[model samples]
Target: MEIEIATIGGYEEVGRQMTAVRAGDDIVVFDMGLNLSKVLIHDDVRTEQMHSLDLIDMGAIPDDRVMSDLQGDVKAIVPTHGHLDHIGAISKLAHRYDAPIVAAPFTIELVKDEIQDENKFNTENDLVTMEAGETMPIGDSGELDLEFVNVTHSIIDAINPVLHTPEGAVVYGLDKRMDHTPVIGDPIDMDRFREIGREGEGVLCYIEDCTNANKKGRTPSESVARDRLKDVMYSLEDYDGGIVATTFSSHIARVKSLVEFARDIGRKPILLGRSMEKYSGAASRMDGVDFPDVEMYGRRQGIERTFQRIMNEGKGNFLPVVTGHQGEPRAMLTRMGRAETPYELDEGDKVIFSATVIPEPTNEGQRYQSENLLGMQGARIYDDVHVSGHLSREGHYQMLQALQPQNVIPAHQNMKGFSGYVELAGNQGYKLGRDLHVTTNGNVIQLVEE
Candidate 1:
């Protein structure tokens, strides 16, 4: 049997993550994603109507033409999570592959929604639902098995797909944090990971997301952010003025916290925006998900109507959890800042930004402008009441200790961004150009050959 890996996308940057593992004649592709920053840099780019080739040319999606270089049939298109950077391109590119789009239940539901909204492509790939801690056979090869190891991320239903092969376990270790006390789901399955390290052939190759590898200390648990959020909302309890909050609409746990705390602080929580309705609605409808029943407005008319109601009923009685934590021009928060919506920001009103500024030129500039606009309107801003979804240096060291893979590949960042991980792995006895592979997009690494 032969084992090979392809770094298709997201090797040199944080978004548009796609990778493939070939076990002999059977290949499994993971995460056909989109580079959101690329899309954000342009004006009015409707990705739903764009061609795959053009999006590739614009660096908005993975250039999957390199898939032809891998001499194996694609057995499964497994997405690790539901984030756009992990599953956005599925609607655009999955039509080219014959494999089923396998993922966790929530992720599968999100993929269905993505496919339904797509206009340029008709992706009819079978959406298979596989929960965490479950395994499915891959291709016709009895020696290959695909397993989903539950991992905690900002979003629920996140997993790290592991391809169990005759050579060893090819662990697709992308976007995740060491969260033991997550708010909505089980903690990061470190016990399972430690077991995988000591079992079978032991992890042959570990591909990691180096998004926060440069930061010191482990990433804080979601529970920490939850506590901070609770404290902030409670402190604003006696205030009679309006309070508006915004976060990553896909962050269900954080949204849940906001909703719960809003009621605790004597306010009705209203979810406003298209993505707010999309993600939270999906979570609310899922089985075993105990999300609160709250009001959500996704359409332009409905959102405007809801804004009018919030103002008429007195803004102090409601908390509007909206989109545009990064200050996107048309998002609910930005429109509120611009006074374009029916909801008005009065003097001394609070705006809680429960997300960090995304480290990109477009995001920084937009966020700065949005904050200044809000400030000019006398809106008091509260920022960074959140924790990152990626692991830091200590967390990376812990993963290397647990997986103890024969080979390590740093991913999800640029060469300079991978430095902290490189230094950490070197302490664990992994070397560059040897077992530690620092690769780029559209490259292949042969770990085993017949």
Candidate 2:
């Protein structure tokens, strides 16, 4: 039996995520996605509307080599969660292979919306939705098995994909935060993670998310973000105008908290933009999570109408949750700044950003321009009132202590980022280029009997 793992994208770079695991003739791929920050900045398009699949032809699609390996033997293409960085490229590239695209329920909803919006992708291959904590067969080949283990991130139902191979089990812990106190979903299923680790004979190799591999300490919980937002909201009860809060739509946990906070202030929540509708709708339809019923409107005309109603009724009567927390020029906030909509921001109005700047230069510039414009208009702006989804260096050490896998591979990060993990792994007795491997995209590492 032979097993090989390759990173198609998101190795030395940040997005366009694809990883392939090939065992014999069968192969399973994870996360066919696009480099969103690059695509958005280079094309000068709004992040959300960057959906036109035509961009793939323009060489915007990240490396598809991972998928090409199983050109015919591809049994499954799974994205661990709904974040665009994981699933965004599937609709654009899945047709190249015949495998089914498997995902969690809410993630499937987001993908369906993408397909519907584009009116593209006509294929009969199965689009499977699996529940968290369930084990599933990858193919009839009998050499490969894949399972989804529930994990916490900014989004609800995020998962860590575990691959069971003849050599041993390899866990792909991508885009996770070891938050034991996630606000919307069950805590990291430590029991299941351990069980899988044990069943796989102590896990031959572990590929983990090193996105925040350099930061210190465990990531704060969603509850922390909620408390921060609550504090910001409580300070503004004396003034009554418009209250607008924007965050990652995939952040169902944060969204839930924001909705509850608005309810506490006696304000009905109003969602605007295509993403707000898509994510909230997906979460509501999922079995376990439920978003409070609210008015979801879109398009400048629709938002303008809702704003007029809210204004005439009473600014204190509603909370407007729109997109553009990243300050994307075409998002609702920028449109509001440009006065393209009928709604106006009064001096006492509040705009709260429950998200951190993602650190991309373009995002920073757009955010700067948008915030300056909003400040000039006298709208109170609150920024970065939230926690991150990725685990930091300290958190990574903790995870290593917990799993204690025999082999460690630092993934999803650049050279310097991988160096940090190498240092941590080294102190723990794992050697560089040996027991601990820092790999590049497309470089395969094989695990063998010790």
Candidate 3:
């Protein structure tokens, strides 16, 4: 049996996560994503005129040139979730291969939206939607079986795909945490993981998320973030000014909590921005969450109209949940801060950042500018009322104990992020570069039977 794994992107950095798994004659790709930090810096006019290769060269998308020789052998392009870092580059890259794109319904909808908006590729490619716990056969001969294991994360319908090859099974685990009390989805499928570990030659290799491995304990649940938001919002019930909150648009659970809280406090809940409309619509369509009474604004014109309505109806009577928690210049929160919206920020108005800065230089600068603009308007700022979605050190430890794979590979992070996984695996008796692999981008590791 011959199996090789290639780290195309997201090994040396935190974005553009793409991995290729070659089992014998068939090859499968997981996650064709983008590096948002690089993508956001490009001028819109220049990026629209640039080709995919140029974008790859500019570090906006994953560099998949290594798969040039094996393009015909590729069977599927699978995305784990709806986050831009996991599904953003699909419209630019999926047309190059003959394989179909397989993902959960929510992710598929987001990708379709991306394709419709970008029109980057004009090719006809098949899109296959697979829900959690379902298994599908890949390749013309059906030589490999791909299964999606349900997992809890910031985004709804996130999954860990397990590929069953002739040699053994390999699990691609990324962007998930074991949240037993998730607000929107079911708990992480730990029992299925144990079943995979104990059955059928067991797991050959486990490539896992290391983004939050440096943290000491388990990552907090989305429910915990709900409680935090409650604590912050409930304290301002009598404030006579506007209350605006910003968070990741893909976080359906957090959005649900915010909407519910706004209603509980007798404030009209309104969602602003195109992304908030897209993600919230997707979630409602998937039956992942219900927001029957919340109002939504999807365009700049609509947002401005809603802002004017809010100003007329008294700003204190409305709760606006917009995008730009990361201080994106085009997002609603930033536009509001720049005084481009109809509703003005009063001297004591509240601006709540429900998301954490991603710790990149670009994000830091953007957040600083946004905060400065808000401060100039005399708005009271509340930041970092959020919880991470990646697995921490203890979460990694629990996953290792449950899976108990023969070989371990740390993924979805740079060297600094991989360090915690290295230490945790070391404690479990997996030596470095032997049973445990700490690989970089463009490196390949082969697993063969003894």
> Judged by TM-score, which candidate is best?
1
TM-score of each: 0.98, 0.92, 0.96
lDDT (0 to 1) per candidate: 0.92, 0.76, 0.87
Better of 2 and 3 by lDDT: 3
Show the lowest summed lDDT stretch of 10 residues, model 3: 41-50
Better of 1 and 2 by TM-score: 1
Residue-pair clashes per candidate, as listed? 0, 0, 0
Ranking of all candidate structures by their lDDT, best first = 1, 3, 2
Model with the higher TM-score, candidate 1 or 3 = 1
> Runs in model 3 with CA error above 4 Å?
43-50, 69-72, 140-142
Q: Which clashing pairs does model 3 show? A: none
Q: Model 1 over residues 145-176: C-alpha lDDT tens digits?
A: 99999998989999999999988898999889
lDDT per residue for candidate 2 within 81-125, as digits (tens), equals: 888878877766777778888888877877777656544555455
